[model samples]
Target: MFNLSYKAQRYLILFGFLTIPVVLSLMFSYYPAFSLLYYSFTDWTGLGWEMHWVGFANYKEVFTRPEIFSVFEHNAYYFVGGLIQTAVALFFAVILTGKLKGRNVFRAMLFLPYVLHSVAIVIMFKNVYHSEYGSLNLFLQSIGLGSWQQEWLGNPHLVNVSLAFISVWKFFGLSMVIFIGALQSIPADLYEAAKIDGASGWQAFRFITVPSIRSVIEMMMILTLTGALEAFDIPYIMMLGANGTDTFVSKTVDMAFKFQQAGLASAMAVVLLLIVMFFIFIQRKLLFRGGE
Candidate 1:
């Protein structure tokens, strides 16, 4: 038997534990990513192995196609809704952090939607947004506010907004939980000290609470941006990307599967990836500009 030092044995064990995950990551994540990048420059129909290098033709088409690029406008509604959701979540998190009764129950109820199946949630909302027989419209009529009812998923002016609201309602609870965790991690003494220095409630929150949870807020902002850019399920499920509710992701999926334009789809994916990365970089720079 060969003898080895304790340090060498530990190193070997560590490497053994990491080997499978590293290999799997390279195989699944990196390899597919690189392959996608390569295919973006080629004309592959995604049906067979046949592919031809087409340079930036796919990229050019993506840029030149007005209808293809215009789907990004739909993402803006979700992005704005995500911002509103974050703000609402932060507000509730702050409130729940206080000595409120039934706060735990409230938190659980708030988080319930996130744990539910995504497909079920979408289907439920589809029924809720039905033009003729939706519960929303019925409730409005019952309340003598029937005039407020409109075609939620049908009207071009309101379809995106309707879908965006669903995203906010479904995901805001998760953001609230995260914000609550961040808020709880903040030391109570900081607020006490601020109060001792005669800081007002708004001043305390603005200065101490905001700065303490700055990193979490930044994370939530990044999530909001990415989620908006990746909005697909609700719009796709409810309206099938009709009535101007199509998002960038749904368009990409259509290009890839429905149209069999694999190369063009890959290019669109790369474009979305670049756009997400650019926004994330800009977000990081702006959020951490004070070196926090």
Candidate 2:
């Protein structure tokens, strides 16, 4: 038997620790991703091994079809909701970071929804959005505002908005928590210095607070954008993508599972991945360029 040096033994131990994770990643993540890319160019029905090469046909269908591309319009609602959610989260984060009475309780209340089961949340909202028996409509009626009641998940015009609101409500607290952490890290002396320099509240927040938490804000924005683009849970669980509430991910799922068009679904998945990557790239560029 040969004796090993300390550095070599350390390297061997590190390699052993990494081996399982690296192999698992390759098998589960990379392999499926590459297989999806390959199947995008084939006529695979996602069953058995009977697939034929049909290059670009799936991609062509994805791009040329009006109904297919139109689902992105639904995604826009979630994007808008995400923007609203980010703003609200930032506002609450700033407020809670201050010397407010019982701010911890408020923070816990806000964050409770995020920790709940997603299915339970959807089911809870389903009852809340029911036209006749919903809590929202009932409250409106109790407040003598019965005229404001409408089909939240039934009307095509308002369905996406309702679903988007659910997403915002579920996720905003997480964003608020992240923002709070970032805000808390900013030095207290900076605010004092700004006060000493006769900086008004708005002026200090604009110049000092914004710049200080810019990176956290940017990260939250990216998360919001991606979450909006990949929105599937709220809409799918609530209405199964009915009444014009279908997002890009839901549509892709329908193509693959419901329609048995795995190839087209793969194409759509690839397109979604590319779109997400493109936006992330643009975000990084803007961040590094400092809005230039």
Candidate 3:
């Protein structure tokens, strides 16, 4: 019998533990992915078995199409909204991580929204944003600022923004939680050292806090961008992709189920994946790994 090398034997043992999960993932994730990729090149209307190979036609139509382009525009609204959410969350995190009364309570309150169901949030906010007798309008009227009241979910111009706001309110807590973890992990010695050198509050924050938490900030930025790009639930539940609040994922789902254009939708999905991958590549190269 032949004896395997020590490294080869170790690798065999490692593969024994990893094999099942790796196989399962390949079967479920990668298999579906490759199938979707192949189907994107075909005219496979989800209902039928007559999948005609149409080579790049689906891809061409996806870009050359304008309705889908409008969908992409909607995604931009969510992306900007997510960035705003991240900024707000970061501010809250910075405050909460510092010396303050009831920091734990405040953290729990901020993080509460993230754990709530999207359906519940959508239903609750739907009333909150109602144009006529909604809580928002009522408050504005009572506060002597009625002119600021506008149709939050009705007006097409504001619908996306309104939806974006709800999305931000619901998920900003996640970013806050991440920021808190990163901030707390930072060494206290650095701040003390800076203070001993007569560093001002702004200087300590700028030089020490910012530099220490920079990686976390970068990670959050990527997460926020990706989350915004793929935004769906709040917009979908509230607007159903109507009034120009359709995101790419929502639109793709609509195509597959509502329009039954599975092939085209698959093609759209592939394009979106490519776009997301492109952004990730750019960020990894330009932002994260720029120093190396």
Q: Tens-digit lDDT track for model 3 on 1-292?
A: 1398888888988988899899999999999999999999998989868899999999999999888867778878878988888878878988998999999999999899999999999999988999987999999999999999999888998998888888888888898999889888989999899889999988987988778888888887788778877888999999898878889899899999999889999999999888888998899888878434
lDDT at 173, model 1:
91
Candidate 3 — which pairs collide? Answer: none
Candidate 1 wrong stretches, greater than 4 Å: 1-3
Lowest lDDT sum, 10 consecutive residues, model 2, at: 283-292
> How many clashes does each candidate structure show, in the order listed?
0, 0, 0
Give lDDT tens digits, candidate 2, residues 61-121.
9999999889999999989999999999999999999999999999999999899888999
Better of 1 and 3 by TM-score: 1
Model 2 regions lying over 4 Å from their true place:
none
C-alpha RMSD of each candidate structure in angstroms? 1.4, 1.5, 2.8
Taking all chains together, each candidate's TM-score versus the true structure is 0.96, 0.96, 0.93
